[model samples]
Target chain A: MRRNLAIVPAFNEADSIAPTVAAIYQWAPDFDVLVVDDGSTDATAHRASKAGATVLRMPFNLGIGGAMQGGYIYALEHDYEVAVQVDGDGQHDPRHIYELLDHLREDPELNMVTGSRFLASSGQGFQSSAARRAGIRIFSSLVSLITGQRVTDPTSGFRMTNRRGIELFARDYPHDYPEVEAILLIHAHRLRSCEIPVLMQPRLTGASAISSTQSVYYMVKVLLAVFVGLFRRRPIEAGDRPAMAVEHAL
Target chain B: MTKITLQRGLAIAVTLGLLLLVFELVRRKRLSERYAILWLVAATTLFVLAVWKGLLTSLSHDVGISYPPSALFAVAIGLIAMILLHFSLAVSRLSDQNKVLAQRLGLLAQRLEKAEERSADARAAPVPGKRSALPDHSEAEAEAPVPAQELSTRR
Candidate 1:
């Protein structure tokens, strides 16, 4: 079996880190869980360590992008064949990791497979608030239009990536509000991505980083990032050997 | 008139003071020579304009500004804006470097921890036939606290 790594980026989620780590281990025993303690003031690192997950402690908070990049870097260094991103708040279901992984393995062309809540017609899980949903819809439409791909949930962080996706993200990722732009990045490099239906639950503990008041700002910032990303030069060739060389040099 | 002379004196003094301040900062190592170059150019331009009254008047007239001191003020503001923009770019670069440093630090720290654990485990259960002088040296080292600081620096 290909080595799988679950990268959980947690910020002050001591209350939920243990359970989240344990659940991932229980569901995906074959996959190794890595909890990136993003400079949490609480005992998040200790709790995650106690839960039997390898903990990577950042010297300071680098937000989600930096934290996840740290995990990708680790994945690259350890030569993991597949990398899964699971949120630390226990909102993302650990059971769905296999489904995402299967999708990646089944499709040779697909570089990334993201778990989307809106993909299913039954709506069995927690769909975000109406306003946030509207924001997600706007992003979904924009990303789809930009990439010429159908992306129902661009904001879904429950994603699995192959070595190529891991290399791209580990090299360059947006600092804030990264998930939506990540799809655009994959497309920029001519990498293929798709989504699968997955059930998501409301966060178990603390309030969301993006509140109602910050939603408008978040929307504008992400839209601007997506627009600006269009102007960035794509460096990878068709073969992707240059990227591998750069990674090796690093 | 005495009023015009006093104004000229004040302008000369201020520009000279700025030039001296920049020199002092660079000399004391508070500011890098790279940044000091911009300040030095700005202060020198202001000093030249201050001492040369006819040059300022003619330059302001050429720029279609009736008031000469306002021209000086405009130039000073433009220079300051450029300096601020330069500082902003520097800050953005510093932050990018800082994030990379933090990420690398975290990754290396984790690697160090794993190495320590592996060494500890090896010490805990030494293979009978595998034991050698090298293993004894490592065991002695493991008995003492791991010199994590030294190891990190070596990397």
Candidate 2:
């Protein structure tokens, strides 16, 4: 039996943290839930712990990237074979975790599997605002063009990874608005990542992390990060990992 | 002649003042020796330029600048830029280390909590024959004991 972990990064999501943690447990009983309380001022840590999820309370806010990297580091240290990121705001359906896990298990070559809301099968899920959707489309096309694979939702945080992906992310991850750049990082390391259709719900509570005023800034920053990611040196070659090669053979 | 002498004296005085300020900061441990070296070099160069009447003029002429004072301005700007850039690099490194420290701290805290819970569980359900699952006496013994007189001094 493979060890599985669900990493939920939350910041002041006191209203939704407990239910989100519980839902992940309900949907995937085998997976150990680890909620990263990103220095929430509210009772998020307490509620998450009460919901039976192990909580790693950061001393201060390091944003989403730092929080998720903490979870990845924990997963790597604990030797979890598979780890899935479930947003604490409850936008990501926990049921889709199985689908992502199945993709990773089925294709050993696939390093990561992201749950995309724009897939045809995803249907009429909450697909963000029109402006953000346009931004997502631009990034989707850019990533698809660069990776030579179709990418519908490059900004989706709902993703699962194998140990190889875990090691890669644990070593190096971007700081702010990292989802799009993370995709480019996967490409840089010559790792395989694909998107699967998943229904996303509207935020259970609280507002979206990116406000209208910040959306323009977010778009420019992410685009710059992506372009810069192209020039970064590849830290790991595809053939370097003998362990992954053996696993693929099996 | 008197005006030129007064200008030279003022320049020398300002450079001397800067050197003394650097020395004072280093002596008080406010500025580190690593950074003090750069300031020392800057002050000494300014002192030389101030005392040497024809040095700045010749250097400016060699660099194709008509004005010697503007050449000094350029050099000062360059030095300031270098120091600012160095500070930026230090700040970037510090923030990176801070992030790593925070992550490690959070992980360690979680592990410590788990270990404490396990120990609490052990103490709560003590076995019959084994040594009681009390807190390890060795941990207490590891600390150096304060003398009774010293302990009572504050009270």
Best by TM-score: 1
Q: Score the docking of each candidate (DockQ).
A: 0.38, 0.27
* lDDT (0 to 1) per candidate: 0.87, 0.85
Q: After superposition, how far is residue A62 of candidate 1 from its true place, in Å?
A: 0.8
lDDT of 2 by residue, A50-134 (tens): 9999999999998899899889988888778899999999999999989888889999899999999999454578899888899
Across B1-155, the per-residue lDDT of candidate 1 in tens digits comes to 32457878899999999999999999999999999999999999999999889999999999999999899999999999999999998887778777888988998899899889767877877887444425634565666655889768656
**Which candidate number has the best DockQ?**
1
Q: After superposing candidate 2, which stretches have Cα over 4 Å from the reference?
A: A121-123, A236-250, B1-10, B127-155
**Which residue pairs show backbone clashes in model 2?**
none
Put down candidate 1 lDDT per residue, A1-250, tens digits, no spaces.
Answer: 2278999999999999999999998998879899999999999999999999899999999999889988998888776789999999999999999899889999999999999999877767999888888889999899999989899999999999999998888777777778998888888888999999999999999999887778888898998988777786763332221233234435
Best by lDDT: 1
Task: Tell me the spans in candidate 1 whose CA falls farther than 4 Å from its real position.
Answer: A235-250, B1-4, B129-155
